[model samples]
Target: MFVKYCTTLFAGIWLLFIADIAHAQQPLPDKIAANKAKDWQTYRQASIADSKMAVYFRALTSSELEAINSAKSNGQSKANSKLIEIKSELTVESSIAGFLLFLQDYDKIPNWLDNANGSQLIEQITPSHNIFRIQFSAIWPVSPREMLIESRYWQDRQGNVHIKVEDASDHYTSHKNHIAISIIKAHWLIEPLPNDKLYIQYRVIANANGKMPSWLANKVALRSSWRTLKNINQQLPNSDWQYQKLANILEYQELIQEPTSGTNEQTKDIMPSNNAELN
Candidate 1:
């Protein structure tokens, strides 16, 4: 349900080709300022100056790179250049049967968020789809945020479940006491292994939608990724969680509507310029 906006890990980062793209274009102020770039519009779309991304990327441990590469479904897209996509998975000491319930209990998601006020279903599109909302409190220098999300759950024949969520702009508006975010893309992959355990992969690519220093953006992205995985590792098993029985999930998979956005891509253009629109 994405209470993630409040989590300390998430507050700082999102899809960021803003990496070298940001640094390469804008030189770090000789005197590091406490504020964002003087010109985010230009910083968002400018030619490379030095490619600080390579250095930052090289700083990553080999394992991190391996995971990021695994998430790429095919050749890179515009998103891969300016955004940072994270892929992480953990083994849950539970059966697929036990885990499906954990996913269904979306209301409890607030317990998993960092500083989220709460989470709940705004509307259920079908057995497999829903419009959900999360409210975030002020996270320091940034304003509090509210997000209306479109999330879909699908269970395949093998019993694996795929949950996808993204920022949705149909009925929600910024006037609702929170900054309305425009881009928040992430997916949860749950695969049931044979030995009474589950393998979970949570991959995310996002654009925080406002503005902040690129350095801050990168730091936030890395920390949030690690923290999110750690929390899920602990949260799922500890909750007195149980699956809610409904129509067979197999049926849910077949009957669910196609992704409401009508797109199955993760990297087609995550970050656009000020005048650009998200595709």
Candidate 2:
């Protein structure tokens, strides 16, 4: 009971922080304010209206298709900037619970996290949200980049998990001799389907800080997203992770529900919705 209270308190405080961040930019025009309010309301109702989540993923898929329909490359973008948006989709042949477990188990994520240096947990914040120190190793001359980030996951009323992981280096010393990413926002939409299938859509918008060409950055971003998606597709169902079972699912659910256990890892939660509007 004590743990539950603390968990609720932390969650509530973080929600307020998120709200402050949302309205931080003042002088909002009336129309923009109205739209923001409408969007907030829609998100609040997302628990019950998971169709919004479904539509969101579908829209992203459609946007990717636009280039193909117009006879252009899928990831071709004329806007040359430091920031890039890369996305990929995958269908995990497992139950919703199993798919989520695969994500939450950060220590074991490298089993399918594509070709990368590695990822280590700084703190397991509420199973759904946690801090991770990751190494992004590229070819030589580029050196290796290390960063600390916080990933938070939330579930809709339909039992789908939406994830948002952002750079949290403000609290840690930046790694030297490597280009640190100044801005990175990764969003994931994991929805449950019939027959225990799970649909996942992952989108990443990032700025690889330092002197890097826009074309190269764009290529790396797109390739990384696609590679990760492909890895998950080929690895998760065939994985030997025990969390794939119903018993393990229930055990994990219990852990999330435990107030004391939550207290051990509770931290300021910065949800993805705080940074980007999903719909």
lDDT of each: 0.49, 0.51
lDDT of 1 by residue, 1-279 (tens): 456546745544533323523332334232332222222211122112211111111122244334445643221221222344445556655544356566556677666555567676778867566887777666556667666788766554344566777666555554354665444357777676554456777656554445544455444545444444555566766656534343434222332344544322321222113212211
| Residue 252 of model 1, lDDT score | 27
lDDT of 2 by residue, 16-78 (tens): 644543342222122222112222111111112122111111112233334323542222232
- Model 1 lDDT on a 0 to 1 scale: 0.49
In order of appearance, the predictions have TM-scores of: 0.56, 0.58
The Cα RMSD in angstroms, rounded to one decimal, for candidate 1 relative to the true structure is: 15.7
Candidate 2: residue 49 Cα off by (Å): 31
Clashes in model 1: which pairs? 9-224, 15-206, 16-82, 16-83, 16-84, 17-82, 17-83, 18-82, 24-49, 101-243
